[model samples]
Target: MMREILINLPIESHEVPNLRELVGWDGRHSDYPTLFERCNFWAGLRVEKNNELIAFGYVAGMGLQHGYMEDIIVHPQYQKKGIGQSLVKKLLQESERVGLEIVTLTYDSKHASFYNESGFKPCSGGLWRKKD
Candidate 1:
């Protein structure tokens, strides 16, 4: 049977828990509501098999000139199925449509080839996290 994969669907605040769980991120679900509300641009994909959310991802950013892609994840069982690539491409398209000059994302070194294949080049930058 063919599954249904919806791209760039409207994201509801209730979906945040599933997204965080899929990516194995530890954070308060409450934090996502406000964060998503403030995003300049965002896109989400939902891969549904019999109405279940099997795979998902999204990119959120703050500025018109530079957009950051985030939480691009395909469920462990669904990796290597091109879902991540499609999700990223969808967000990039949206970013460009909104006049964004650059779309940026950070990923682990192990995933470099995937992003490279998706047309991302190695670039230098720095990151600093605030102490909590």
Candidate 2:
């Protein structure tokens, strides 16, 4: 079943550290609060039974022509259960609902097939890159 999703909410006490530990990053990332506050769109997937945040992702942009997906994190315990794909699909939908002309993301190629199934293509298809 699909879990509950919380949208556009402020980061909580546990979230950034949760993500940091999941990905093995060290140090307190002081910049994340400001960054999370500035996201054009973001969401957290909550476990239905207990409302625990198990996954999250965000898109940052100027809210005009494009959005860039970043910081997609799924707790290690929840990996491979389709949670990551679901969060990403939600971000994609938000970008579209806001009338973005395009959306882009970079991911480890180990997960290339997942992104392909989620409606992304290679940058060579001429849809993404930094402006000249």
Candidate 3:
């Protein structure tokens, strides 16, 4: 049987704990509060059976005309299942609706293929970093 995977966006703080379990990101438990407060942007998650979070992603920055995709995650069991692509397409569409000029992200080389397949290209001249 094919399992259902749904992308639910902008989940509330209370939902973070479950996502933590799904993704096993211990840092998220400690850092998400401050991160969320600073970002003040909508986040997204993929839910299966309308209950469990199978994947998650978020956007940051107020310059809606040129935003960035901050995070995208799919549960280990759910990778290579097309869930990530659906999530990305939705993100791009939402960004475009607000007149976004570009949606950018820096992927680890190992994961570059996934993003490239989703229509993302390398920036020949650009810099990105995580602020502590």
Candidate 4:
């Protein structure tokens, strides 16, 4: 079965946990809707056969000139198939379409090659440590 990519669609509230599980990230943040709904963009990868969400990623930056991409992950079974790259490209495309000047994301050093291949360059700058 082929896979399809759906961009900028409102994510149903029920699927938040599954989306979080894709990367095995922090699960303690129980208030997912508050955060997810506030995002400017969301990209979901789904199976064409059943419309099941297999991967997800999003951006947060006031939907303005700057965007910080986060939570980019693909299902374990779906990794190495370029799905993540596709999501990243779609996110970049949509953000640029809105006239965003720059897009940035943080990733593990081990994934440097992926970000580099995706047209991202490292820039030294201030770190986020406190809330505004």
Looking at model 2, report the run of 10 residues with the lowest lDDT sum: 23-32
- Per residue, candidate 2 scores C-alpha lDDT tens digits across 5-79 of 666755675676667677676525665677776879788877667666678788898999988898778878788
TM-score of model 1 relative to the true fold? 0.80
What overall lDDT goes with each candidate model? Answer: 0.68, 0.77, 0.66, 0.79
Instruction: Encode model 1's per-residue lDDT on 21-126: one tens digit a residue.
Output: 7668653578666766666655554555454454555556666588777767666666787877876777777778788888888889999999998889999999
lDDT head-to-head 2 vs 4, winner? 4
Sort order, lDDT high to low = 4, 2, 1, 3
Clashes of 3: 1
The global Cα lDDT (0 to 1) of model 1 is: 0.68
Q: After superposition, how far is residue 61 of candidate 3 from its true place, in Å?
A: 1.3
lDDT per residue for candidate 4 within 7-83, as digits (tens), equals 86556665656767656865535656776768887788777787777778888887768989988878788889898
Residue pairs with backbone overlap in model 4: none
- Give the Cα error of residue 78 in candidate 4, in Å: 0.2
Each candidate: RMSD to true structure? 2.5, 4.4, 3.8, 2.6
TM-score of each: 0.80, 0.81, 0.72, 0.86
Winner on TM-score (1 vs 4): 4
lDDT of 1 at 99: 85
Top of the candidates by lDDT: 4
Backbone clashes in model 4: 0
lDDT measured at residue 7 in model 4 versus the true structure, 0 to 100: 80
